[model samples]
Target chain A: MGPALEVKDLCRGFGSRRAIENLGFSLGHGEILGLVGPSGAGKTVTLRILSGILEGTSGTASICGISVASGNRKIYEHFGSVAENHPLPGHLNPFEYLQLRACLKKVRDGRREATCALQACGLLRYGKRYRIGQLSHGHRQLVALADAILGRPSLLLLDGLEPRQLPAVLGELPIRPAVLVSGRNAAEMADFCQKTIFLDRGRVVVDEKREQRN
Target chain B: MFNFFALLTYEWRRISRTSDFFSAGGLFLLLSGLLFLFALLCYVGKPQTVSPFAFWLGHGWPMVLLLVPPLSADSIAGERSAGTLDGLLCASPAAVLLAKFSALLLHYLLLWTVALALQPLALFLASLRLPFPLWSGAELFGALSLLPLSGALYLSCGLFFSTIARTQAQAMAATFVLLFGLLFGPSVLLRFLPACRWPILEDILVRLGAASQNGWPDRFLNFGTVAFYLTATGTILCLSAVFLRSRPFH
Candidate 1:
C-alpha cells in the first residue's frame, strides 16, 4: 500500500491557542488509519481541513493528489466525510437524501448508486422505511456513513464514531478506499486499524504499525 | 453547466419534497390571496378603480416586495447554518450561487405566477374581461417586466444577506429592513421632502419609475430600470460569491 493522502505540518488555530500544530501523516490506499486521541486532540479539526470545510492555518493536506486548498472545483469529488453530529436534512428520508447526494456528486445513475451505498452500509432496510430524523441515533450515524460512501469516493473521513459503535453496519463499511477514522479509544482504534496514530495536545505522539489485515 | 444543473435538480427535489412551499412560501400565498380579496372588495362598487393593472399597481407587487424576503431569507444562510455548504464545495462558489439562485428563483417564480395570475383571474370573473394587455401595450410590457425584475433584485439581496447572516431569522430580518428601505425609502422621502422644488431630484425619482400612477417613464427608461435591476441583482450575487469564498469555513 502507498500513500493516497498526505498531511505535512498541518496547523490550525482560533484566536490564540493552536488547536492542531505541526501535525503530519500519510494514509495509504486500502489502509484504515485510526486517529486516536483524547478529547480536543484536534481530530475533528484535521478532518475538517482535509474535507476543505476548514482551511488550515499553515501546511498542506492533500488527498489522492488533490490539495484541499488548491481551489480545484472538482476537489471535493474525490473525498467524502461524515462529521461528528453530521446534520442530515431531517425532512428527507435516508433514500431521498442519498439520491440527492448522488445527484450532487454527479453519479451516473443516482438512485441506483444510492441504493447500493445504502446496502453497503447495511442501512437499506431502515433507510427505505424512515426519514433520517425518524431513525435512532445509531441508525442516523449509519445513514450518514452510507451517504459518504455512496459515490465511492477515493478518500473517506469519519469523525466521532466510537470503536465498534455501529454494530449492525460495522463490518459493512467498504474496505478498499483509504479511510481515516477518528476516536478517543486506543483499544478501539487498534482493533480496526493497521496504523494507529496517537495525538496529545496538538502533535502526534505515536504512530504504531500493526500486522497487515487479511 | 452539468454540474450546476445537477445541483439545481437536487435543490428542487429537496425543496419540493421537504414541502418548503408551506413555510414562507405558504405565507406568501396567503398574502396573494388577500391581494385578490382586496381587489374583489374594490371591484364590488367601484369597478373603475379595479383593473388587472390597478390591483397590482395599488397592492399586488407591493405585497410581493414586502413578503418575498421571508421566502428567500434561507436561500443560502440555511445551507451555511446546516453545515451543508461544504457538500457543494466541489463546484466554484459562483456556480453554487447560480444554482442556488436558480432553484430559489424557480420557487419564487412559481409563487409569483400564481399570485400575478390572480389579478387577471379576478378581473375576468368580476368584469368579464381577461387581464392581458392589462394596461396599454407599452405600459403592459413594462408592468409585466417589472414584476420579475423586482423579484430578481429582492431575491439577490436575500441571497447576499443569507451568505452573510449566521441564521435564517437574521437573514430574513436583515433582508426585510433592506427591502422596506428600498420599497418605502425613496417614495416616502421624495413625497415627504419639499424637495419637489428641485427639478433634478424629482427627475431622478420619475426616471426611477413610479410604483404609484400608470407610472412608467418612456420605453427607454423602462428598459433602463430593468437593466439597472438586473445589474444590481448580478452585482449582489457576485459580492455574495466573493464573500462566501473569502469567509473561512463556517
Candidate 2:
C-alpha cells in the first residue's frame, strides 16, 4: 500500500518570498511524524501543502494516493486538518460547530459522530450549548480536536499546537491515523514522533528516527 | 448538494442569531411608516396623486438596495477575516458561495415580504386601495414575482465583492460604490463627457442606466429588464464562485 502521505519536491512561494523549497517526505501508515522548526521556518506552510489547504507552486502531495494537485473533493475524503488559527465560528455553540464539521465531512450520523467525539475529548463537561468563543483557549482546542477526530480520517494534519497538549489530544483519538504535527519545539517533537524532520529556511536540515522508549 | 444544505442550515442559524437582520428590517419598516405618514399629511384628499403603492414603488427598492451593500459586504469576507472560512475548504467554493447568497437573499425576502404585507395594514386603517394591492391577484403577483430576482441580484453583487475584498468594510464600500455607480453613473458621466456626445452611444448608456431600472413598478413588469437583471444576477453569482475558488489560503 502507498504511504498515508507522499510529498515530493514541494515548492511554495508568496510573491518573491519563497515559503517552502523543493521539500520531500512521506509518512507510513502507522507512523506519527513531527515537523520541527523555528517560526518562519516553513513548518506551517509544509503542513498546509500536505493538507491541500494551500496550493504548492511546484511538485506534488498526496494522501492515500489522491493528489492535492487535483483539488478534488475526493482527495479530502481520507483527510482532515486542524489549522493554526482556524476560525471556529465564534457564534456557534460547541455542539453546533461539531455538527457543522461532522456534516462537512459527511459522516453517516452527524449528531452521533459529533457527540461521540465531544464525549471522547471530554468537552461535554464544558457544556455543548456554550458558544465556542466563550470557551477557554484550551477548551477551544479541544473543540478542534473533536472536529478532527470525529470521522476517524486516514490522514490527520495538526499545526501549531502547544507541545504539552499533544498527549492529551492524541489520547482522545478513537482511531490512530497516521498523524503529522508541525511545531516550533524540538523536544516535544522528539518526545511524540517516531520520526522527526527538522526544517530550516524551507528545507529539511535533519531527519531523525527513534525507537519508542517504552 | 449536502454541503450546500448543511452550510445553508449553519448560515441560517448564524444569520438569525446575529440579529443585525431584525435591526435592518426594523429600520426599513420605520422608514416606510414615516413615508406613509408623510404622504397622509402632504397629499391628504389627494390620494390619486401620491398613492401608497406608487410612493412605495419609488422608495422601497432603493431602500432595499441601500441595505444590500452593508448586509453582504461581510458575508464571505468576514468569514475569511475571522479565519472561519479556512475550515470550510472541504465544501466546494460554489457550494459555500451559493449558500451565503441563498441564505442572505432568503432573509431579505422574508423581511421585505412582511413589510409588503404591512402596506395593506396601513391602507386599511386609512381606507385606501392603493396598497401593493393583495386584492388584485395579477397586480400583486406581478409586483411580488420580481422581488426575489432583484434581491438575488443585489445580494450577489455584495457577495462577489465580499469574496474579492480583503476586509468586510472594504467589501461593503466596494459594493456601495459599484451599486451607486450602476444606478446613477450614466447621467453624471454624460456631463463630463460632453465632447463625446454621440446620439447612439448616449442612447445605449441611457438604456443601461437607472432611468430604466430605478422605477421599480414598471421595470419589474418589463420582461426584458427583469430577464436582464436575472441574467446579471446569475453572472455575478458565477463570478463570486470563481473568485471564492481562486482566493488564496493563508
Candidate 3:
C-alpha cells in the first residue's frame, strides 16, 4: 500500500571523509531494486543507514512510513540485512545461529523456521553441529542470507551476493519482501532485480527498470 | 527486558563454546595455582609469617580484576571485526551492550566459583593443615557484591573499546593497556614519586586494588558494594548506549 523503504537526502560522513552524502531513493512494496556501484560508492553505508545500524550525518530514513532514527522497534522488525562480509557468531553452528535469530525476529516455531531457512540456503545438512568457523566463505555467505530471511522481514537488504546464491531467493520471492540488492555486475543485477539504481560517489547516476535495460 | 535477557543468553551460549573463554579460564586457573603453590612453599619453611588462606584471598581477588578485562576484551570487538556487530546493532544498542556485559558477568561468576572451590583445596594440600576459611560469611558476602560490579565495569570498558576499535587485535591491545594502566600504573607511579609519599595518597592507591581495599573484600557482601556496582554498571551501560546511538557503524 506504501513504499517499503524511503530515504530523503541521507548524508553520513566520518570527519573529513564523506561515506555517504545527499543519497535519496524509495522502493515500493514487492519491488526488487538493484544498486550498482563501484567500491566506496556508499552502497553499504546507504543500506546500513536505512537498516538503522548507522547514524546519518543529516537526512531522514523510514521503513514503511516509520522513522528509523526514532527508536521505532517496529521498523527493525520489518527489515532484514545481509552484508557482503558475513557476520555470524563463529561459535554457533548454522542451526543454533539461525534459531537465535529467529527468536530475536519473533518468528513462530523457531526450529522449523531455522530448518526452512537452512534448507533454502543449501545448508540444511550442516544442521546444528557444523560450527560457523568450519564453513567455507560461500557457505558462510549463505548462512547470512538464511539469517536475513529468518524473520520474514518486509524489506530485505543484500550486498554483493554471488550468482549461485541468487537461486536461494527463488523460494523466497513468493512472500515478496521489497529487496534492495547492491552489486558491481550489471548482468547479475539484471538477472535478479526488476530495477537498477546506479550510484557513483554517493549520488544516483542512473535509474532504470529491467525492461528498459532490455 | 525479555529481549535483553534473550540477547544475553545467546551471547553466553556463544562465549561458552569459544576458545577465548576456555583458554582464558584455563590459563587463569593454571597461573593462579602455580603462584599459590610457590607462595605455600615459601610459607612452609616459615609458618609464622603468612596465613595461606588470607594470603590467597588477598592476592587472588586483585588477580581476578586484572584477568577479567582481557578475557572480555574481544566479546564485542570480535563481533564487529567479524561483521556480526551490524546484525546485533539491528536490535537495540542498549540491549546489545547489556547482553554482552551480562555474559561477561556470568563468565566471572563461574570463575569466582572456581576460585572459591580452589581456595580450600589449595590450602589443604599446601599447608598440610586443615585450612581455616579466611572468608567469613561477611567477607564472602562482600566478594559476591564486588564480583559483578567489577566485572561489569570491565565489560563496559571493553564494550566501549569494541565500538571504537576496527579489529579484535586492536581491541585486545587497547584493553590490556587500559587494564594495566588502571590496575597497576598508579601503584607503579606512586612508588617512584616522592610527592605521593603521604598516607592519604597511599590509601587511595591501595583502595583502587581490590585486595587492599578492606571496604571491598570485607564489606563486599554488604549493600554498599551492590549499590556501587549497580550504579557503575548503569552509568557505563548508558554511556555505551549513547555512544552507539551517536556513532556511525561504518
For all predictions in the order shown, the interface RMSD in Å is 2.5, 1.8, 2.2
Over 4 Å off, model 3: A11-22, A172-174, B39-56, B120-127, B130-210, B213-221
Model 1 accuracy (lDDT, Cα) = 0.74
Docking class of 1: acceptable
Residue B225 miss distance in model 3 (angstroms)? 4.0
In candidate 1, stretches whose alpha carbon ends up further than 4 angstroms from where it belongs are: A127-129, A162-175, A211-214, B18-20, B23-27, B36-55, B119-141, B188-214, B220-222
Candidate 3 structure quality by residue, lDDT tens digits, A1-214: 6799888898988889888778788999888888998998889888877776678899998888899888766666788777877567778888988877776676788898899888878788987768998998888888888888876778888886774466556465458788888998977788888899888888888889989978
For the candidates in turn, chain A alone yields TM-scores of 0.91, 0.93, 0.93
Q: Report the C-alpha displacement of residue B11, candidate 3, in angstroms.
A: 1.6
User: Once superposed on the true structure, which residue ranges of model 2 sit more than 4 Å away at CA?
Assistant: A168-174, A212-214, B19-21, B39-54, B119-141, B184-226, B248-250
Best by lDDT: 2
**Best-first order by TM-score:** 2, 1, 3
Q: What share of the true interface contacts does candidate 3 keep?
A: 0.48
**Candidate 1 on A1-214: residue-level lDDT in tens?**
3368999999999999888999999987877888989998889899888887788999998888878888775656677788899877776788878887777777779888888888877777876688776888877777888887877777779898665754344355555677899999888788878898899887899888886432
Angstrom error at residue B85, model 2 = 1.4
When 1 and 3 are scored with TM-score, the better candidate is 1
CA RMSD of each candidate after superposition: 4.2, 4.1, 4.3
* Each candidate: chain B TM-score: 0.80, 0.76, 0.75
Tens digit per residue, CA lDDT, model 1, B177-220:
88777665667667666855887666555533445434333642
Best by DockQ: 2
Looking at model 1 chain B, report the run of 10 residues with the lowest lDDT sum: B212-221
